[model samples]
Target: SGAAPRVDPRLLAEGIEASRRAAGAQASRLSPTAAPRQVPNEPVHQDGLRGLVERYWDNPLQLERVLIGQVQPGPLSPTEQAQLGRLLVEKHLSADRGRTLSRIGDEQRNYPNLARALGRSFQAGALTDGHLGYLLGPQGLGTSSRRGFEYTGIATLVAASGSPALQSTTATRSWELGAKQTERHAAVDFHTAAMRATGGSTEATQVLLQQAGPALIAAVDAVADLSRRAPVHPYTNRFSTALGTLLTGLSHLPSSQATNPVGARIVGHLSEQHLTAPALRKGFFDYLRSARTSRSWRGLGPASGNAFTQQELLTRFKDPAIRNHIVTEQYYRMSQALEELLPGQASWATFAVWASRQAGSAIRGEPLAGASGTNANGVRAISHGNTLGASEIAPLFGAFAQTLRSNPDASFQEVWRAAGAPNKPLLREAFQNYFEAYQLRRSGGGADAIAERVLVANTLVAQHEQTALQADIDSAMRVQGVSMWSLELDIPGRVLDLNEDLTGQFPPELRYLRNPRARQLEQQFGGWGDSRMESLFNLFRLNQRDAALHGDWVV
Candidate 1:
């Protein structure tokens, strides 16, 4: 007879029985919201693995991402989810991709089905081989024993058709021999047929390349369009602004407020707060280069501030003190004014007044004093109010000024609305034109000729910039090994759209100046500079000098 069971074994058995009894009595019923919990009919405890395999096979497209090394297999832990999101953003968006991925991960936590939600990220190339290796270690399997069948299916097919599975004298050996014999005969026949085909390998390759040129370029152009320019994100914006402030502050003596120790401390504090100042300033200057053409800034996008949307503003500027002291406060106020106008009520004039006042304050009590002279009322400043024959409006405002002059019939309110108010250039131009007749009186020259010459110069500058941009885009694509034809078919409209978006803040007059009509006009007449009126020319000279001086006067 078998030896009697130990007392410990008996006691363990009893405890296990008791625990099962207790668990059965206390187990809660499944809630209605829970997923269907049908146990598999098969006794195999490999989990829903079988069903997943069948489903994946039925939907081959679902396996595309997995095959391409995107969307690592298995349920993602929170960390894995974050990793996948980052890969998606980096591969897709050219902007501050890491930040975008973080945002996506944060947002998707609320999704009911984490697996399905995570799966969507795979639509784009989400997974990289490095990510998979890191996740799975030396063995490709994850925490769960279940492996992706996509690999298994391919392996099964490759192995079944090619192997030494049989030995001599066996029935299987006879069939293997037969199969080998048939394959050998087929190979000989195929080689003989190939010898009679076309010219040689080189000729065939040339033919294939020629045939593929268009499609290749279109495809490349599409990718090129997508990869055109990385966005200058908020960090870049802050960096640019800080650099600009530093440069501006350094160029001119510190304001009276900035001269004291406390003021110096405040300057340091401001620098700390505006992290994207350097990038933001660069973006601003880049916009000048970008907008020098006739491309709409809509495609270029807003630099630092959100356009018409108060969400970013509200999120960042909840504190009244911070909002009031920072220049972004001015931006927030201007944005708020636009929000007010969006409901169909016209606040263009109101915004014009607001923007002009801000510009005035920027130049107030400084060298810009004479440039701020008002008409009969303090509300409206003289349009051509250049001090000592110099225009105080920033170089950026030149385009807007031209716009207003070109379209004299347009109201200050109308032009303001069109120009996207709180937009300095638009306001500057509107104000300049509001007092344009005054500028004509001051300049002692024919208004029409000056306006014509200025318009022409503005048009040419815009055209050249646009042409340069298109050429640069083409060159970049070629450098990336992408062909132009491939890009055209795959992403024809994408380049123009993106370029326009990158320069969205630009005034319309400056955008789209490279269109065929613009070129034709330039050829028919003189270059852009010839259209400038005597007063406008004088103002241009003053602005040019000031810019040079501004550049040279830095401490």
Candidate 2:
């Protein structure tokens, strides 16, 4: 400390000049009509104060630098600092402030001082919901892994600064927008990119799982924390839906060595916080109860010509096919969670009973026979005309029962595998059964006529499944003798061949059968499933299971 570090006069001069240049540029942008001004060596004047406030309003970064003496050695006088802070707070309170505050908060470089000003403004009731909302918007939090943490800090700061009303409003809007961005769009992009990188290879997929696991966990944690802070917020439902979507996407990833640890972490976190909690079950059932009476749910998709009353629509929600799809998706997530958390400790019998109870409760209100109305196209029809019989979902239950009977101590994974791992096939079969039953019931036939109709429908479904399976088998057999490299190269052609074999199997006449049941089935499940990705994943799993069962190799 001989001479205490001497300041370089030249460096100090350069720094002041740079600050002047930066301030000038910001001033010009903020107030284009104002004449250009220069920083003076003397005490600040009114014009300088006005220009400084303008710059602060538009660009918080420069203001922060100046305030911290990064641009100049000396701080502003107390009076000038107060004036600048007051003006900035006034801007924050204004309705027309736009997203400038949010941008500054997200920059994070100047968060402490900005948060202080925001806090003061909130204390004075000068900060509006608009300001708080902008600060907590999707743009503020962003979709980057780093931004997720930044969002937590910003949200906490804002929540602490204001009344619950403002805090709740801001949190709701933030969640509404952020949920879609992070859970839907961003998650989809991550999955698509990972899939492309992995090229469907188990090893590559495992690497991706390890890399992305932390970020995924962080995102879910942030959502849970936010939801806890504002439990009554409307966006809470959005958060729940987002969680379900996240689980679905993660479950679709192929199981691998790397995925085991990652999956365990996720499963553990969810079980601790939500999945295994009674609160979650209560919340979900509550939602279903509310949704049953909701106009939106009643009016789902296109309006049918049958023009159902609200009550009729509510009754139709009890349709077995619809219930099966909903229950199966829930069961899928629960099964995956149990597999990772407890492994073989959980029995298939318990899950089967739980699933059955949930499905029954979800569709408990009405019998399918009660629904009589016209079609969406205005033609005469039954209101629940296309509803499946209670027995329609019996095959799926039978599959589970058989699995449990054969292996009483089977884990969720074993039972799932034994039952064909269901997924898209479960929904497809549910739809098939519903359509067949509907057609048979509507055919003006007694028991004998219905029996014959059932036989014909079963034959058709069996034929379609066999044909699809055989086509895949034939393609694999054709390339069995080829080298691995050649086989990889030949897969596209084989896929095309399989498609050709499946073409025209459901001819126009059969698909357009006068029965509404046939038309609805063709329209909904005609392509097998809603998503190509789901269909592909299900097919891969089915092939793997088949090979394991038969002690044979998969192509």
Best by lDDT: 2
What digit string (tens of lDDT, one per residue) describes model 2 on residues 259-344? 33333332233322343223233332333232222221222222221222233323434434344433433333333332232222
Evaluate residue 317 in candidate 2 and report its C-alpha lDDT on the 0 to 100 scale. Answer: 45
Alpha carbon deviation, residue 66, candidate 2 (Å):
28
After TM-score superposition, the amount by which residue 212's alpha carbon in candidate 2 deviates from its true location, in angstroms, is: 6.6
lDDT of 2: 0.36
Deviation from native of the Cα of residue 224 in model 2, angstroms: 4.5
Q: Which stretches in model 2 have alpha-carbon errors above 4 Å? A: 1-209, 212-230, 234-252, 257-555
List model 1 lDDT by residue over 174-222, tens digit each.
Answer: 1222223334333222111111111112232123223333332232222
TM-score, cand. 1 vs. native: 0.19
All-Cα superposition RMSD per candidate:
27.4, 21.5
Cα lDDT, model 2, residue 332: 37
